[model samples]
Target: MPQSRHLATELPGPRSRALMARKTSAVAGGVGTTVPVFAARAGGGIVEDVDGNRFVDLGSGIAVTTVGASNPAVVAAVQEQVAAFTHTCFMVTPYEPYVAVAEKLNEVTPGDHAKKTALFNSGAEAVENAVKIARHATGRDAVVVFDHAYHGRTNLTMAMTAKAMPYKSGFGPFAGEVYRAPMSYPFRDPEGMTGEQAAARAIAVIEAQVGADQVACVVIEPVQGEGGFIEPAPGFLPALAAWCRQSGALFVADEVQTGVARTGDWFACDREGVVPDLVVVAKGVAGGMPLSAVTGRAELVDAVHTGGLGGTYGGNPVACAAALAALDSVERDGLLQRARAVEALVTGRLHALAARDSRVGDVRGRGAMLAVELVGADGLTPDPALAAAVAGAAKAQGVIVLTCGTHGNVLRFLPPLTISDELLHDAFDVLDAAFAATSTTTASAR
Candidate 1:
């Protein structure tokens, strides 16, 4: 279907409100929704709620629908695969689709070196397994992650993740041997701190505190997602990768939100030629299907014992089929170029907004994955209130924007590559009005 934003009624119309009431009664409070309006259909860039509201899909189901939510190829592949077989379990009766997906991941993920791939049910699972493989391979226990990093929600990942509020609050007794290091946040770093210097600072922390030799891997998101769409300054990733090589630690890229052409590259690390020893991928990998993978060096991955890896539903045939279709769409539809086009269009508008509004503290990210970090008058204090105000306003106006960052102050954009430029511009119109209205409200309060 053609993409366009249209609100037939007030946000979360009566029908949606009714459904939400039922949801509250039946669902866990932790399972949240950005908007109460449930989706009836989604195609191109529009997610039509049950109440006939067509919202511009800026979140892309949290960056999972990179090929659009209802791509014909993905739908057909899924249907065909489901008809043939749902699951015999890859471990029990290994399937061709699983092998195909692993082959494709090995081909596309950064680095020409001989690589292997292990598929899983979610990004967190892939990350956990990656750490397991790295630890076993390197014979080291300590794992280093950067500040403002968001690995996942599982016990070990929660320990690796830096944030403590929504992701970590009440989820305690996290796994051990996970160490945190400073990130190369150019926007917050001291004036004139180069990426190399920032990398050196992080390395110093790892060496002095964690001891480089004890490190099994340095895991990082090439462009942070939940911790804000932070793009570490140039040379940051390479320096860490080099250090990993020197210290016999694996370099791991948590490209869950920045991989599979979402960043205009197969993986975000490809942008600077920083190939990781292991690449953990999810979100956008299977065109909305729940699938993730740990793809990297064959030697390191194979080092794990034969029965050391895998889950029962790790590489479901249906999800693998969907992934194959999604991969095909990336190459055939030129989604890599499409992502860059999105970056140009959205980044231009975001920068223009930042130029005029001091609240838009920083505009950063790559390709369709972009964000506007909100801040107070000092331009340093995070303005999560304003960010919430803008996002809430945009959702009401039919633009489905999402908020993130450890401070909850970053309005992140993850539009589908298939979105029409007209729809994007229309969403931005709502965003512009939202910013202006919120600014006026805050000004009045002050």
Candidate 2:
């Protein structure tokens, strides 16, 4: 088996703390708190901190390195592209890498209909552009999104987003004509609403309140990412897609966190065979480079006049090259299928943990994009304090984990699909130990 973490000293040793201070001094004012350990380098499933502590990387840079950090093919392709030439700016002088990536996206994204793709620099830009295309195509003003959805952080996306604490708090006076609806949250929905019933209720609200005729698009994350990895019930997404088609509303699937094989399919929209008019992709697109895109129906994409969509570094050559190689690597290596295998590994461990601990309210997600939601003994109330403690304890044990959700009580795991089975299992073992230890501490405190 690969070597497990070797912790020679405490995390954030003297050297790491000094670096953190330098970062705080030099970096922007609003940058968030640095995590427990400062990474020196990462590969496969492990990140080495400056203090020589090896940590099992379960976060995968917030789901950006699905094909793995510094993948050989991605590194080689980027190096080759840099050696020849870097950016000519896709707007001024377009390059093949950008076109090639767009072509691949057109062919690979869920829709089989005639499709077009435009690249951008971040998930928020892709989402904003998707909305622009939808509004242009429908000539409508309103866009409807679900409660608990996380589109992005830009002003327009912030308006579309449903969570208010961090992504929307104090950041608003947001864009107008954005509406919110309920999600098919199986865990929390009313006593008897089936998945289909939940979807129907939401549609009713849209038709009666928002007026389908005035809505330009309906956007969703097939599996709610930041809202705690809540997978929509079986029939919800397809039914919504059908409703959008009948209402002349464009369906935009925000696959920024759930796309690129992280969820057992090239896109979650494909898993349900519910092709959206637009699909926003980023995070894992460039194998860690800053790149994003909107892929959708050709007519909808072309509806925007030429030069209406694009940015200065939308499809930078280096990132484009990395994306092409990453996509190829994902396909050739069967990372999509590998994602399911990783999911099984995670669920097997996490569900077992849930079985014993009442604090673990749920283990839910598809493929590698999984999370374990924490709750108090009542099994309904969110347990944010326990979740934070669990994450901090895991970090002390030389493992990286992330917490997210509307209530901030979900421990999300986004290990790279390229992580070895042994490494994944090792991380789970560490998690199991951490949970056991934390449970003991909780018992003692009580």
Candidate 3:
């Protein structure tokens, strides 16, 4: 089979089918999967299934492998760290790699305002900790989040998330004092509403309903990840940050999916020159290792008591070692520029597709994180069925694509930064074919 993408048999071939049977009995139903074929190995935008089929990976394991799933440097670092020591528990006995990773985060995150970092095991934990720090620092209780936001799965974060079906359904007794504000979704926003105007609208609600003085922090994703990869209108983020500053509310940037050179910048907020008081990072941070962090102003982070913020696996030495090496790969490999290049290729193709198909209502996003919102014949009604059909067609053709958005009518592309140009273009070709196939079927059904 070719290194790029080759199918020796149908998707979820014999070996994969056998594995699926085992997984069905062992794994819980709630833990879903996109592709049924179990991966034997993955690297450089290609996943090889146990059945010997190769697939082009457009979904970089949901953007967790920005530096590639098995980056050599990260692998070596993990190996060395495991050999030395896996986990002594940072709270029990601190290690050099943990402190070093925190230092690196402080230096790289936006602003030179004497930042500090607290590591966690996942984005949700980091977000929960950020809320804790904010409340402690401000002596306020209310925490503000945006509509179309996806924080995490923890109880508090599930409350922070906007969507209700899968993430919030059946879960109850959520954290209180969490206020939801309207996001600056340009495509859905009223026509001619500038970013500043949108910010003012959300701020008005915050002031009126939540009371700015009662709010400790206003947490938002500069480019919302699960909310259809929605990039806020220009000037929107800066305006919100300014309001947070004036109103004495901490501004938190949930960059879990947008950080680590994923959005063509160190952080998406950097594009707008918006320096958030607190930034949550995960997913691509450690080259697929389970690690997350909250990096923020010194005073706010230090406001917590000496033993206030920590977990047993927070800043695990192995994960920290992987992060250090992954950071080096990002800088040395110039993945930031590469992410921009990917945006150009993907957006160009998606925009052309929209021109040819009315079902593609909007093509938007930045860097490697892009999405196309599917609509019905009238071009306004969301067509989630079409999105699902397109995604299924692509998957059958050995291209791994992921669907997201509040309505599940958006097809998001989050290819690894290290994906070769040839492979990326091939994946787009598969997508184009998928859209074409799905559109024809839809027209016939109508």
Candidate 4:
């Protein structure tokens, strides 16, 4: 009966603890420990835990539910699709929703040139398939990826990913011909190189080590999501696209985290006016229904043999229906503009905080995909311990925030684009309080 968000107890109250114990017995051994909260239902910006505690959702189910939890149109579409039929598996018999979603992707994704699309079940699958398309088109085997990037968990994508902890520690003998190159992390790069200089250096490495002739594709996240919400320096992406053009290598933009209006633009690559040969989209595409796509240059995409692409569950009818609804919501509600509004709000607040605390070394990101990188007073040394403590303390205060990056010292914000302005401000207030509570001294005092 409550309309306002409320936390009746510390998160993961007693009832949630009991449920988690039961879940552990049935779940996998590798599952991360639950946050101890059992959700009864969620709608629009709020999630109600089983213990009657209401919390504003900032993570958006890891950036999937951008239309907000249980969006009306999405729910309606899902319900209608379920009643009609759940799975026909595009590979099995095919359906209208699958093709319709593909048509929409081709229409919306950047590039006036002809394009084609293939549906998949997750971002990783879309990425892996994109690589396949590039390889088939170029008859090359080598692929180049940036350091600190997180593509997906599948064996091939795992090899593509740069992090080592949970994603690739014991998973050995990963897919071959995947090479790692330094990303444009201006915040951490040696000798404060300009964005153009950084791009040249990375391009040089790719040309020298991999011999672009042997490379099928060069994959990158326009705004590195898991690697830290690091936006490529100006001229970086366009330069890479130009080099890819010159070298005859496919340029793939992994927009798993930056697509679907999550960033202020429809796609971060578009913001720079750079059109990728292949774009991998998912996570927020279907409003949390598990749909992904590789919208690519038509010639490269069509290069694959008839049976070379597709999966049994790649374009499930339900997920297709959900994707239509999600896209509609983004357009009808003007969520792209809403995302920019959130960026202004978050960046303004984070900048103010950074000015007072040297620990807050940087505030960088585009649209609503914002993050704060914590560092020591020197602004050169990462302070993962403080970042963790702040995140843990924020959770204790009933605000849900997430930490990411190779160093694990970046706190990224991925609030739903549909989140209300009031809720957005309230979340900032909670962050301000968390900052205050966690601070021992100001930059000047130290």
TM-score against native, each model = 0.98, 0.96, 0.98, 0.97
The candidate, 2 or 3, that scores higher on lDDT is 3
Cα distance off (Å), candidate 3, residue 5: 0.5
lDDT of 2 by residue, 1-446 (tens): 13467787877787788988888899996667527567788777778888888888888899999998888899999999999888889999988999999999999998679999999999999999999999999999999999888988899999988788878889879999999999998877777777788899899999988998999999999999888888888889989999999999999999999999999999988877888889999999999999999999998899899899999999999999999999998899999999999999899888888777778877899889999988886778998888888888888888889999899999999999989888788788888887887784232111
lDDT of each: 0.93, 0.88, 0.92, 0.88
In candidate 3, what residue range of length 10 has the lowest lDDT sum?
Answer: 437-446
Ranked by TM-score, the better of candidates 1 and 4 is: 1
| Pairs that collide, model 4 | 12-36
lDDT of 1 by residue, 1-446 (tens): 65777889987899999999999999999998888798899887889989899999899999999999889999999999999999999989999999999999999999899999999999999999999999999999999998999999999999999999888999899999999999999899999998899999999999999898899999999999999899999999999999999999999999999999999999999999998999999999999899999998999999998989999999999999999999999999999999999999999898888877888889999999999999998879999999999999999899999999989999999999999899899999899999998884332211
* Model 2 lDDT, full chain set: 0.88
| Sort by TM-score, top down from the best | 1, 3, 4, 2
In model 3, where do residues sit more than 4 Å from their true spots?
441-446
Per-residue alpha-carbon lDDT of model 3 for 267-353, expressed as tens digits? 999998999999999999999899999999999999999999999999999999999999999999999999999999889888888
| Top lDDT prediction, candidate number | 1
Off by over 4 Å in 4: 1-3, 190-192
Query: Clashing residue pairs, candidate 1?
Result: none
